[model samples]
Target: MNRGRQLFGTDGIRGIAGEFPLDPASVYAFGRALGRWLKQQTDQPRVLLGMDTRESSPTLVMQVAAGLRREQARPIFAGVITTPGVAWLTRTMGFDAGVVVSASHNPYRDNGLKVFGPDGFKLPDQAEQELEGAILELRQAEPQPLTQLEPLAPQSSLTDAYLEWLYSHGPQLDGMKIVVDAGHGAASQLAPRLLTELGATVHSIGCEPDGRNINAGYGALFPERAQQEVLQTGAQLGVSFDGDGDRAIFTCSTGRIVDGDAVLWLCARWYLEEGWIANPARVVVGTVMSNFALEKALAERGIRLVRAPVGDKYVLEEMLRHGAILGGEPSGHVIFLRLATTGDGLLTLLQVLRRVAATGDDLATLVRDYRPYPQHLINVRFQNRPQLDNNPAIQSVVEQAERKLAGRGRLVVRVSGTEPVVRIMVEAESEQLAVSTCEEVANAIRSAIESG
Candidate 1:
């Protein structure tokens, strides 16, 4: 066992299925650990369990449940539901905790566990550290072999209940032409149905999930497929959802991609124009990954942009901290704090459509005024780990680069949370300046890491 190693990342515990962290022993231990913690919360702990369409998800869920059962805790299964659905059900349907057994955008071979508390929010880092400590201790006393685990059939009522609640917040879509790509993940069945039920002429893609096809050549990460579908179908707009349906990317009728920043600007403008707040602070939350264009646009409208760390969890934290109603990431996860606990592709699309419908403007028409600032990104890979924030040499290099910026734009250098690389982003007044500045930072980082 890898003792003293970190088990949880920004999202949750993730790795290649059947490996150390996700192996049977560790997963079972994780369940027992979570169960033990839940026991401290209440006498009878009922955990809501959900997973994406991964071949490995069922066994993992079984292992977790069995572990929980061993600790006298109950695991309430909501089989093959979206991540947000589990969160919603956990908060609204009275569960002590919620566990999502799927890697949001990873391949079939990879999987993860995301835990949510009673408030439909992901457990904080301190709580995750506590769970990791418990798991590490319990893994030494691994249990015996388990019995046969059968396939799970979801209670249709549970999924239907989620859709019903989502529909309640959606506007009418009568005779509206749209394209939906569910990425063959958890939303494969739900996205199309929701659009159809709302009276939209829907052209669907990526709705077939064979357990291994989730996020393969589809989803928000690959919006090209959805864009092609939209162009071919001649639909008014297209929406592509990542696996687990937590995030979404959109395509205009013109086949141009509408990312999260555009969605934010559109939504923020609409919210203020429609009197969502009386003399509202008009604070919108964005991640460090957000384009500088968004910041400038919001500032021009007297709206303040507060940049949080990389994760959507952190974004929500900032939203709650500032009491802001809207926040999101460029990766297509937009959080409408008032409507959904976390980011919901469906909820975001509904809000975007409401904005467009209210203004009688097309997606392209609405985003035309928001020009993108020139930004360049460079990913520098290293042999050893790079503690970007803690490394004095790296920090010095970064500070020098910041001085070069001269307040014209922004520069962000951080280790990629999900990959083994350092991402350097530079946003400047010109594309040449952005590219040069980003390259300068990337080279300096390489030198610093190599020398150190």
Candidate 2:
């Protein structure tokens, strides 16, 4: 057994398929731990399990079901569903917890496990820590044979429930022309069907998931494909969803990509205009990576934009803290807190389409005033992540860059949580300056880290 803190990450336990931590044995153990946790909460606890269209998903699902049955918990399988679908079903079906076996936006070879509470929110940090501790403690004990567990039945049909919820909860997108790119992942099967059923003329690409093709050269991570498809299809707008369909990217009719910052700005404007958001100030939460234009645009409308760290969790936290209703990331992870706890790419897409339909304006025209400033970002790979504030040389370079940009631009530098890389970002009045400044700052960071 591994000692100290387990390998759980900010989202959940994730790794390359058939690799350590994500291997069958470890996944089975994780399932057992998850089941045990729920069993302790209530007798005969139920959990909804969902997965993306990854090749290895079936093996892991079966292992998880076996583990759950070992703990005497009921496991309801919602096969090949999106992450948000699992969360929605968990709350709607009154399950004790929801588990999704997918690595959102990651390559097909990689997989992940994310657990959400009955309220459809990701497990709190402390809850994850406790769960990791429990797994570690259980690992130290003797392992039980798989044959000892009773055979569990797979109960499906949560997808229909999720579809029903989508149609009823939010406004319909009738008579709209929308293009949806499912990234060949979890939403490949459901997103198009739901949108078409909601009365939209849907043009879809990347909807055929053969397991290996999930998120391969498509999806929200790469919106260029969807953008081109939208332009070719002459659709009103386009939505690109990540592997598990928890994040979304958009494209206008002109093949121009509109990221999360722009999407949130548009949504905020629509919400304020329709009085859908109760907050008079029209509070919206965004990450540090959000373009300066978003803040400026919202400020122009008497709306206050709250900046959070570069993660949906932090964005949601800030939203809840300030009683805000909308929040998201620049990477297309838009969260409509009033509708869903976590980011739901499909839900966000539907909401945007509703806005377009209601206003009778093309998506491009609707977002014309929300143009993002030219932003440049450079990643500096390091042997280890160092405290940038503690490094005087790096700090001096940042200050110099900031002073140079002055009121015309912004600078942000931080280490990535999921990778050993330092990100240097700069936004300015011109694209050249943004790129040049980012390079200068990145060079300084590389030099500082190398010197130390």
Candidate 3:
């Protein structure tokens, strides 16, 4: 519930790059604030910096590094790397903090900044609020000339280290035909090569980054492209990663899209059967956006589902608090708390493949039981967002919808953390009911905005 943050959003400060909050001045101030905070924690604290393949990433890194140098903090450069790669390195390499310059699934024209603590997780809200205060104070301060900034070469050894770790730990995909769509982002090189080395027949698309093409008609946002490829090639499976490689969506051999909910079910069943879970019936953490059918299926198996607010960080928090090992979002941000501190597309994909290989089941067959309820979601853009909970008209409309559903459905309405929009979701036993209920709620919100 923390408020009054001017720059930092739920997923970190994101916007069209070279604009407010991402321009040279604001970015440098943010870096300086972060460097000072690290210095406060410990003198000479080291920070690991990584970025995706956006054309502006290199310059942004240089500007941020310049600010870090001012506070005597060491910045280790990891160029063109995935978001989770920075998080993993931060924990393994013992850096005080890690910074990833990526907008994730956002288009190339946009960019963002995400910070991982020494524990390799996103910063807690209190810490982020404190950092935001410092950043705003420094916003008006003088900015160093971009031309005067020196380019920092990537630590080639660190990249090699990450690759080695993946090879040593991840499952071998031998004899499998897998198609990977990197979305022309951070995983452009690593994903295809890693799968090939693991003995999989790898076919790669969207691996070429022209800097401007990241997430262009590919990746999680456009999984249909990967589905088409899977069908055309008759591949055993297909995976598509977001711009920063933190999340992924999969396509089964039958061209069925397997989202995070299905993946969670697959992993939960695997761990339960494998006797890997310490507690079999405690809870599996997921967002409110998770399909209601997932909850029902798990309940039939004596498993409980705990719904956290949207965001992988919130899911991770609930996992830690509840001591649950499995949790993720439907958007393919799966978190294996035992393996990683954040959502990792590559790790999740490999784990799914490993489970398939071990269970001797096709991906589609394995997830056949996860027949999701007919859910409809709509996003309505607004110029100024008002608190829906405080609006009597919106609340009344929602209450009416709830009574109509009468325990046969669910409704979720909230503001987008990253964009200026309100999201409405409805899930029911029938698509007609779901779509009609969802539209009613959306229209109410739209009317509220218009009236305001």
Candidate 4:
């Protein structure tokens, strides 16, 4: 395992916008490092930059852009765009690389820098390591004042090209009433407009971003509001996107929550039925956090379920390894590798909506077959980084907990890649058992970590 990668987490270099890795000096160095690396790949590299609606995003963009400019590389601005938007534009528009100045689903005070290659895929592990080394060396030297570069304006043509590409893949929905929740983040301005242009009657929520309000009361994780809005608006579907718009969640017209697992099953079923997949026995990729019943449903259809680590990147890697077209996380990061290089919430919703129109069935009816096992999740915060997957104290408690399950259920204890917390998930046939085991494991984890 490449534990040497401390700077880059599962997603990217994430932190409070003004702290350590995200600080003005460090952020600038990061940009310079990325620029220098791009220079090595090509002369006068054209790097695409985009950001979320966070108050910190603009400053970070300027810092990174200054750093890129210092390295004699050009930064093309795609201001206030989704993460996938930058990736798609980078690959399709002949840019050497892309960088996003938003932390997906993180609060407005927090931010990150995610780098993508020309193919719209994230930089591989080795590439990030090289950049991190450069960033560190640059940061250790005398901190130079951030340069005030010329103001950058977003190229409207780039945005139009991306929207056109996405629209081309989606089936038009004429007269379909829809509810849109953009989480007051990257999709705040784009999602509602896109849906309206697709011929849907759009009722938008969470569209007002006040710099600090992104994900405060609205996002993919908060479905209650979308559920209520769906019921009240009498819309056929309700979609909620995350802070960066790469993840999404859905609610049915009946206010029923149709989460990522249901999305997976729905897509798998469509692929199998349409013979889009050569054999029904193909595999679908999911994370360890995926519901066990998702595995069973796929198995019943002669399809195999492969579990990757709990990250969209890991799920994408597994998809590539297995040649799978479909993969997703329970947190709403669904990747249709056939269409997109990453998990695009907008694209995923479009595909699901297309499926709905094709089948003439609502979300509830389409996902009625996926009965998930009882699941309980508990997150334990730490004063410092809590040890896991290797610490003996934690391992002992986990071993005891697994024995308690005795093959009747599953247990997953993992550290959060984005936050300083350890999450415990317990799954069983009964909710009571799931909850109790989860509490037991949570207490053990807390005690073990605290005692040390």
Tell me, what's the RMSD of every candidate? 2.8, 3.1, 1.6, 1.5
Q: Residue by residue across 246-334, what tens digits does model 3's lDDT show? A: 89899999999988998888898887776656674568899999999899888887779999988888899899888899899999999
- Model 4 per-residue lDDT tens digits across residues 327-354: 9999999998888888888998899988
Residues 188-285, candidate 2, lDDT per residue (tens digit)? Answer: 97888888888888888899999899999889988999888887888878889999998889999988799999889899988888786677556899
Better structure of 2 and 3 per lDDT: 3
| Model 2, position 188: C-alpha lDDT score | 90
User: Per-residue CA lDDT of candidate 1, range 279-376, in tens?
Assistant: 35678999999998999899998899999988799899999888898999988899988787899888898888887778898999999998877888
User: Which run of 10 residues does model 2 get worst, by summed lDDT?
Assistant: 142-151
Misplaced by over 4 Å in model 2 are 1-6, 142-156, 169-176, 280-282, 447-452
Ranking by lDDT: 3, 4, 1, 2
How many steric overlaps are in each model, in order?
0, 0, 0, 0
RMSD, model 1, all Cα superposed?
A: 2.8
Assess candidate 1 and give its TM-score to the true structure: 0.92
Relative to the unseen true structure, what is the C-alpha lDDT of residue 359 in candidate 1, on a scale of 0 to 100? 80
- Ranking of all candidate structures by their TM-score, best first: 4, 3, 1, 2
